[model samples]
Target: MSHPTAPPPYEDHNPLYPGPPRPGGYGQPSVLPGGYPAYPTYPQPGYGHPAGYPQPVPPVHPMPMNYGHDYSEEERAGSDSFGEWDNRKVRHTFIQKVYCIISVQLLITVAIIAIFTFVEPVSEYVRNNVAVYYVSYAVFLATYLILACCQGPRRRFPWNIILLTVFTLALGFMTGTISSMYETKAVIIAMIITAVVAIAVTIFCFQTKVDFTSCTGLFCVLGIVLMVTGIVTSIVLLFRYIYWLHMVYAALGAICFTLFLAYDTQVVLGNRKHTISPEDYITGALQIYTDIVYIFTFVLQLVGNRD
Candidate 1:
């Protein structure tokens, strides 16, 4: 058995770590009775420090600011507006082509009329061959109606152009023959009035919000009635002439064709629910031209009767 050695005296300090005496051994608070690792220590008022020490402050960091942002809503709105603008541009282009075609048809008709009216030989020849003229006019009218119904806007370009041109020339020649019967002064006055009426109606149709396309069914019924009325009036005028009845017929015809013009113009503009296809520019022009032709014919009749 080994006996325990006696501790050194208080005056004999440790040679390896020589220091002043501490209130606590090792100058730290111990967690266990025998010193191992020490527990965390804090400053105490009655200990080496009279007052507690201040705690260290943590550094503050600012929140990140996002300078650039996504503008998805604005971009979407701009895209929608651009799409609407493109639609309007396309609609306007279709309308322009229709009008251009109608203008060409009108010019051709006017040129034929001028030639027949001003040139004496053509007018005399047509007047002398009245029977042959009627037969030819009937054939032309039949051919025009057949081609319009059959071909329409379905055929390819050059064929469509050729058929429409032939039909227009035939119709114009007939119109020229009719105009040759009227006095030059009467024809001029009627043409001026027809042009003024056409301009006014076109402007009105363009600006008005009223939907004429919806009234197509009603117009068709009215057309049949007008045709019957015209036939009766023609038979009456042939057997027994009534000046007032002729005037009424002319006035009614003019009104009908004017409404037709407004309706066709709306269809061409594509502002209606039931609209002509954008590709059917030729059909649109043909409808408008027919309306104008009827209007002119009625106006001429009214003026010719007055004379």
Candidate 2:
């Protein structure tokens, strides 16, 4: 030991061999046993971070424990029942509104028909001045087109009411004029038959499972057939009135309009393939009214003893 410790026992240092442990443990540089160059050491990392490094923290905020309460069975049932009731109420209201409008229109038409039928002076004047009938017919057609085809005018507030009133008046005048040519007894009978048929058809449509609203193609075909038949009948009548042919045409018209009444009623009811919206109450009333009036006209033509 006093002789330079025998020069540390003369070891051969190799570059690939591991060095001796140092006094500073794993993180310090250490020399080999043969005095080789010191190699650097680093601390090993833990599971999620470096052994000596600080861990990052995430920001926190309060969260609602229960966002919404679970509805009980009774509460859910109550909600469903309420929804059904509300829907039924709305539908009932719409139907009532449509019927009220129809009632007023019919009343106006009935008054006009009475005036033209009973008032001899007015009837004579209407017959003498055919121009008045033509004018009223023109007005009826114009207003009918606007209401039927133009949604904007039909749905607009005051304008819709105004146009509908004018349309009804013109139609009433035209109807009254035609009625004036028929005997009062025939008109009254026709009115009775029309009212009975309308009531029966409406009741049937409301209760029946048959969906007449899906018969659009059938309706169109019927209309075309009716129109063609009427044109042929008119030509025949011009040559010479055949009583049977006229009767047949009138019967066909009445039947077709009766079907139309059923279809329109189903549409208004909305439990069908096709339906009119609740907002289109005016349109619905118009359809039903037209069907009834046309039914009356055809019935009158079929049964009336012309004056």
Candidate 3:
């Protein structure tokens, strides 16, 4: 034992090699200020020790240390800026379209309505009372059908919105004027109430936190039913005495259309995808405007009919 010397320790130097397994998770129980671990130490991958020998400090590279993944503040800021720009562009384009669609449609519609409504008083006396009204109605119905069904390659929605609005105003004015002979203040008041309700529903969709995406399908089904009911009722009016029934159908139409308005607005705001096309912002606005106008008119009928 007096002349015996131990053999030199073995050394292996490959970075990727998984060294001897640790008894516990590594990098835990952080070293104390003096470099001693608070608890028993776990060995790093290259920290080999023979029996009864103390651990040695391993080699560190000249390159920067990589603790798996590290994020720099500069890199994080650049990524955030790019993301914000893209989102802002999308939102800005969307809002521009919204105003363009709504404004064009409303202007055209109001112009047409003023031309006719202001020219004709509701109390004007006319011969062949029923025939003239039917002809006037046919003109409006034809216009509405073209606006609803005509979807072509050209950006016709703006033109259509203009046309539809013009016709809508005409219809409203004529209806309002003629109904004035029978129009108690009640009907106009009813219309104002309906407008308030419709606007309230729209505001609630945007403002209130309750999610309304699920109601889209329900609104579409009810909208179709309301349109069909209006058509069927109009047809049946020729065969029977049901003017009061028309008012009832009108009320239902108002309710259904209000729901459609809520659903459609949500789509424009990206909350729903109820309609297939979104690029034609005007078309969507017109659909909403048409529904609201119809609801207002129908609501007016209740006021007009009330004794």
Return the top candidate by TM-score: 2
**In model 2, where is the ten-residue run with the lowest total lDDT?**
1-10
Error of 2 at 54 (Å): 20
Give all candidates' CA lDDT scores: 0.74, 0.84, 0.57
Off by over 4 Å in 2: 1-86
Using alpha carbons, what is the TM-score of model 1?
0.68
lDDT of 3 by residue, 42-82 (tens): 44333334333354454343456766656688766754434
**1-307: candidate 2 lDDT, tens digit per residue:** 2323122221333445546532222423344455543544433343235353342233232454556966678877765434333487888998999999999999999999999999999999998898999999999999999999999999999999999999999999999999999999999999999999999999999889999978799999999999999999999999998999999999999999999999999988875677777778999999999999999999999889988
Q: List, residue by residue over 244-293, the lDDT tens digit for candidate 1.
A: 99999999999999998988888777656557667677788878888888
Q: Could you tell which candidate, 1 or 2, scores higher by lDDT?
A: 2
Who is ahead in lDDT, 2 or 3? 2
Runs off by more than 4 Å, candidate 1: 1-86, 132-136, 151-154, 305-307
TM-score of 2: 0.73
TM-scores, in order shown? 0.68, 0.73, 0.55
